[model samples]
Target: MQTSDFLAELSQLTMGFTPVVDPIYGAEVYRFLDLSTSNTIIDSVDTSSAEAIAVYIDTYLSKTGGKVAYGGYLEKRSIYDRSLYFGTQEIQLKRNIHLGIDIWCPSGTAVLAPVKGRVHSFKDNKNHGDYGPCIVLEHTIKGDSFYTLYGHLSRASISELEIGQEFNAGETIAYLGEPEENGDYAPHLHFQIIKDLQQNEGDYPGVSSLGNLSFYKENCPDPDILLKIESKVKG
Candidate 1:
């Protein structure tokens, strides 16, 4: 389907789930990660110390029981030079190369269906800075297949969700995984749009370095089109 048509259908689907309720924790105490400043590459971790990284992950898990939703690694890379990784150097780095939009919220937050579709696949990525519990949905609009990925979710999110199970837009399908279940970081949801997955299932890289900019741009379109309130949500 055309990008416009796909976006329109996605908008309709998301409208049904407006004012997404917090999945793991209640809204009042939890703070939504600011998306405006989010344009910058998130160097939240101390890359120098593996032990420190492990401790950070442990702290997130301890607080939310591994239920944080949108906690994972995000990168910014240059489109022109694939080898030149953005956000790596202290100088000449711009955070414009955001690969995916993230929804940072508390763990255990109930993650609802953004659109009506079937459970395409899921997996437990055990790496320290990866999507610990992730789910992907296959959607068909006008006979063309597209996919949406929800990364860094609670393990329980997919424990009972079976492949091919039909989910209605706005229906509560899973809960936000805590940092332990999610890759260690503040709880949040990594929402991504993939035009072509290249046959990959269960897991896909959400962040691409400057070297793979062209490929990611074509493969993963802008998710903001579907997330109508990008401005409000980010603000």
Candidate 2:
């Protein structure tokens, strides 16, 4: 199959990268949650508090029989209701489609950069159910420019970072933030591949409403294209 020049470059870039978590590339099983399905547990999730979110994820992990829960790219989630920041009041179409891949794991788990890149921006989006502490890295692979966004990260992740600091592949760029500091939700890293920043700084939309799904999906392709963990997902 023929691939685009951009994707071809991305493919080359990922060849030497490591798993975001050691377990995903090892013997441990990882569950893929299809939040887009009608029977998903997302309907029952109570986002009232940080502890509640932890319990919800724990129960899900147990049910799926995996230490790590992955999936969520382009998946519609009802849990976004917890935050009014998602969409404009007049839009009616709420932003529930997740634009990034989420890795649900215990707090303090290390997060690795999948490629060599320079930090473009970093900020603490301090809203309930927001990205909390986030970092966006800019990269140029074979002349094709792109960006990687690491959201819901520990405050310490960007505490010492500068705008243009560089990171090599497989380097521990950050740790999974605790719920208290990670948008008041379960500990997870929201990893996204963005084709453009649209002039946004320190943050980008990780979710889009139904009306905007096509546009967002195009700008942010499936992260698995770079993650390359399709077989690791539990059947």
Best-fitting candidate, scored by TM-score = 2
**Regions of candidate 2 where Cα sits further than 4 Å from its true position:** 1-3, 22-27, 88-92
Best by lDDT: 2
Counted clashes in each candidate structure: 19, 0
How well does each candidate superpose onto the true structure, as a TM-score? 0.67, 0.89
Local accuracy of candidate 2 as per-residue lDDT tens digits, 1-235: 1136666667666643237754344425567766563745555666566677678767877986778778898886767777877865434477888999998888788888888898999999998889999999998866666899988888998899998888888888888898889888888889999998998888999988888887888788888878776644422
How does residue 6 of candidate 2 score in lDDT?
66
Which residue runs of candidate 1 sit more than 4 Å off their true CA positions? 1-98, 231-235
The TM-score measured for candidate 2 stands at 0.89
lDDT of each: 0.60, 0.79
Model 1 clash number: 19
lDDT of 2: 0.79
Clashing pairs in 2: none
Instruction: Tell me each candidate's RMSD, in Å, in order.
Output: 6.9, 2.8
